[model samples]
Target: MTLDFSVVTGAWQSLLLGTVGTLFLAFSGMALAMIIGVLGVVILRMQLRLPSLLVNAFIEIVRNTPFLVQIFFLFFALPLAGIRLNPTLTAILALGVNGGAYAIEIIRGGVESVPKGQTEAGLALGLHKHEVFRLIVLKPALRAIYPSLSSQFILLTLTTAICTSISAYELTSVGQRIEAETFRSFEVYFTLTGIYLVISLVTMWLLAAIGRRAFSYPQR
Candidate 1:
């Protein structure tokens, strides 16, 4: 089909609105994931076997399963078990929890890569475990793995499209609505594809800047 300017204009409008929803879902999910990731990494660093095993198991399960299935389970199945959440809230919770699991593994790897000698030296200097981890381990781990963490966050942004399945009205869902209205599937979706690409690029750039600023000392 020939590219229709009218269709492009209308679809682009809808896509812009959908982008708001997309941003909300993606950023909120990442925020929650950050909390989960930090906690998981700290627990793993406790060197407790059971905590390590539990965290690892959660990571594997979330990473291995399809995100769509996880979303569906949280949205549909939980209500049957006496817990109910609105669609948007359920979508965010599901995505956040799943993304958090991946973040845990990534952050845990960074924590593990910290030098044993560094911990020993801190202890010899009479530092507490928490003090050592906060001052020495956390910064180094963040610096070493910031690139990986940023990539995961980017992936999480794209994963927001899964929210469409639950009618979350994110960017992809907006494109779907436009396609249905105008029957210009190609124009509708390709426009959205470009929008998503731009959003992802800008997000990664911002994340790189933040990582550099926050982790500057570690680089030195």
Candidate 2:
């Protein structure tokens, strides 16, 4: 038997909107994760036991728990505590918090990769500790770990589909609605699978380009 993809043309608009929503969710999440990762690394590098323990706890909690549950907690459970977040904001927070936990570890590895000599040199050269870490260590470390960070970001993008479970109205949700209206389950999901693939490919490409530009250095 042949497939009937005639429904796609009709569902096109919704799919496009859903795609935008998905991209917004993924990008916002990754950006917030980057902030958290950078700050977390700095805190960890300070070697302050209490702060490090707290950061570690945050990472372990997010990493060990289910992401879907995290999103639900933000969207549904928070209201019980007299704090309410809109679906989009909750989705971003969930994705960001989850991705950030992993990002912290990955970035900490990067920071540790820097030679101890460099840190010593910066300190001897009259730089403040924070300045030394930021200028002499963090940048090069980030460059070294760019590939791992990019991969993590891609994984974070794929996780955007989970946002649909909380009614964040991303691509997966759109596909589900389309399937209900058109009664074409296979077609809906098959198309969504392809769409996700394309989305990931484009995201990877963009990340690569940004990495090259942001991390590139002049030849010695």
Ten-residue stretch with the least lDDT total in model 2:
1-10
Assess every candidate by TM-score. 0.91, 0.95
Residue-level lDDT tens digits of model 1 in 64-139: 8999999998889889999988877887888789889988888888888999999999999999999999888888
lDDT values, one for every candidate: 0.86, 0.90
Worst 10 residues of 1 by lDDT: 5-14
- Global lDDT of model 2: 0.90
Candidate 1 lDDT score at position 122:
94
35 Cα displacement, candidate 2 (Å) = 1.3
